[model samples]
Target: MEASPQYTLTERGPLRAALKTARPQEWVKNVLVFAGVIFSGQLDDTWAIGQALITFACFCAISSAGYFINDLNDVELDRQHPKKRFRPIAAGQLPISAAWVISAVLAVGAIAV
Candidate 1:
C-alpha cells in the first residue's frame, strides 16, 4: 500500500502564514466596487465615494473569508498537488483551527461593516 505523504510544519510565523492564507493580492479585484460610483459620475460626491470605499472594504473581507474557507476545505487535496502544496494550510504553516476562527471573524466583520 502507498503511504500518505508526510507534511512538515514550515518555519513561517502564524501572522505571516495567516496573511498568506488571506490572499491580499486577490483583494484588488474588490476595487471594482468603485466602478459604479465612477461610471455614474459621482466621484465628486463624498457620500458616494465613502460608500464605495466601504463596499470595497467589505468585499475584500468577505472574499478573504471565502479564501480561508476554501483553503481549509481543500487542504488535503492541495497537499497532493505540486503547486498547491505550497499553500499555507496545505504546507502546515497555518493551523486549521486558526483558519476557521479567522474565516468566521472576517465573514462577521464584513457583514457588520
Candidate 2:
C-alpha cells in the first residue's frame, strides 16, 4: 500500500495561535451578561448598558483564560484524540510557555476590568 501523508504542524504565528487558543467562537456565551440589562428594560440606560458590556468583556477574557489553562493541561491527552489533535497546543502550533503567559495576562485583565 502507498504510504500515508504525514500530518505536520502548520506555522501559525504566535498571535494567530494564541487567538485560536482563545477560542473566540466560544465568547458568544458571554453575551448572556447583557441578559439582565435587557430583561430589566435598561436598554435605554447608557450606564447600565456600558456596565453590561464591560461585564461581557470580562467574562470573555476569563473564559478564554480558562480555555487556555484547560488546553495546556490536556495537551498530551488532546494530541491523542483524532479531533482534538488539531488544537493549537496539541499540534505544537503554540508553545506551552506562551500559553501560560497568555492565560495569566487574560486572567489579570479580566479581574482588573
Candidate 3:
C-alpha cells in the first residue's frame, strides 16, 4: 500500500490562511441586510441604501469574527471532520493566538461600523 501525502501545516502563507479564515464565500448571505430597505420601499433613498450597505458590512465582519472564534474553540473537533480539518485553525495553518487577535480586530471593526 502507498502512503498518502502528509501535510505539516502552514501549507499556505499567513495572508492566504487569514483570507480563508474570513470565508468570503459566505458574504453572499449578507445580502439579506438589504431586505429592510427593500421592504420599507426606501430603495430610492440614498441614505437607506447607504445604511443597508453599512449594515451588511458590519454583519459580514461580525459573523466572520464569530466564525474565527468558533473555529478556535472547535479546532480539535474540527480536525476529526474530513472537510473541516482543512480549515485554517483546525489544519494548523493559522495559530490560535493569531486567530484570536484577528477575530478581536474584526469584532471591533464591526462595532465601529
Candidate 4:
C-alpha cells in the first residue's frame, strides 16, 4: 500500500495558522486595484492585468507576512490584551519561531517580485 502523507500535529497547526492570518476574505479589497486599471481602459491590456495581478498578490502576501511578524514580536503583549489574547501566537496555538520563518520567506518572495 502507498504511504499516507506525513505531517506532524505541530506542522499542521502552523500551516493552518498561516492560512488564517492571510485573511482570504480581505482579498476582495484587491479587486479595487484591478477595477482602477479597468475603469481607466487599461483592461484591454494584458501586460497591465498581469502586472496588477502580481502586485496585488505580492502585497496581500506581504501584508499577511507582516501580520505574522507582528504577532511574533508582540506575543507577550498580545496575551495581555483582551482580544489579542486569542491570537494564534499569543494563545500558544502556533509557535513564534514558525511564524518568523514563514514571515521571512514571504518577505523575500515580495522583495524578489
Candidate 5:
C-alpha cells in the first residue's frame, strides 16, 4: 500500500501556488459567474462567446499564477511530502524562486486583462 505525497501549509508564501493547486474550486466559482449568461440562451452571440472565452482565459492565467506561487512557497515541504515529493519544484525539476516570479507576472497580466 502507498500514499501520495502532499504539500504542507507553510506560514509564508506569495499566495499563488495554493490557489493553483485548488484551481478546480475556483473554476467552479467561475461557472457560477458565467451561469447568468449561459442558461439565458444568449450563447449564440459572437460577442458574448468572446467575452466568455476571455473570462475563461483570465481564470486560467490566474490559476497558473497561483500554482507557481504555491510551488515556490511549498518547495521545502513539498520535497518532503510523499506525493508532492515528485512535484517539479520539490523534485528539483523546477526552481522555487523562478516559480514565484512567473506567478507574480502571470497574476499581474491576468488582472490587467
Candidate 6:
C-alpha cells in the first residue's frame, strides 16, 4: 500500500488551506441570523444579541461543514477543472479523509451549539 502525498508549509501551509476551506468570505451571510432580533426590536437586549451571535457562529460552522463535504464530493471532478483544481483538497493541500473528520466535527459543533 502506498502512502498519500503530504503538503508542507513550503508547498502549502495546512493552516492556510484549512482557513481557505472554511470559506470565510461567505461568513457574511451569517449576518442574516441577527435579522430576527434586529427587526423585532430586540437589538437593544443583551440576551438577544448574545443568542444571535451564538446562532451566527453555529450557522457559520455548519456552512463551513457543508463546504468541506462539497469539496470532498467534488475533489476528483475539481482536479479536472483548471480553476477548481487549485482548491485545497483537489490541489492535495488538504486531505480528503481529514476533510471528512473536519466536516463531522463542525456538524457536531453546530448541533451542540
Highest-scoring model, TM-score = 6
> Residue-wise lDDT of candidate 1 within 40-80, one digit each (tens)?
99999999999999998899889999999999999989999
TM-score of each: 0.85, 0.86, 0.81, 0.79, 0.67, 0.87
State in Å the error of residue 85, model 2: 1.2
lDDT, candidate 4, 59-113, per-residue tens = 7878778888888888889999999998888888677777788888888898789
**Collision pairs in model 4:** none
What is the lDDT of every predicted structure here? 0.91, 0.91, 0.90, 0.79, 0.68, 0.91
* Candidate 3 segments exceeding 4 Å error: 1-11
Clashing pairs in 6: none
Candidate 2: where is the Cα deviation over 4 Å?
1-11
> Candidate 1 at residue 19, lDDT?
87
**Higher-scoring candidate on lDDT, 5 or 6:** 6
lDDT by residue for model 6 (1-113), tens: 99876776456677678879989999998999999998999978999999999999999999999999999999999999989999999999888888899999999999997
The residue-level lDDT of candidate 6 at 35 comes to 92
TM-score, prediction 6 = 0.87
Clashing pairs in 3: none
For residues 7-92, could you state the per-residue lDDT of candidate 5 as single tens digits? Answer: 54453233434443445555665655466468778778878777887787788778778777777788788888899887666766
Question: 67-107 in candidate 3: lDDT tens per residue?
Answer: 99999999999999989999989998888899999999999
Clashes found in each candidate (C-alpha, N, C closer than 3 A):
0, 0, 0, 0, 8, 0
Model 5 scores a TM of 0.67
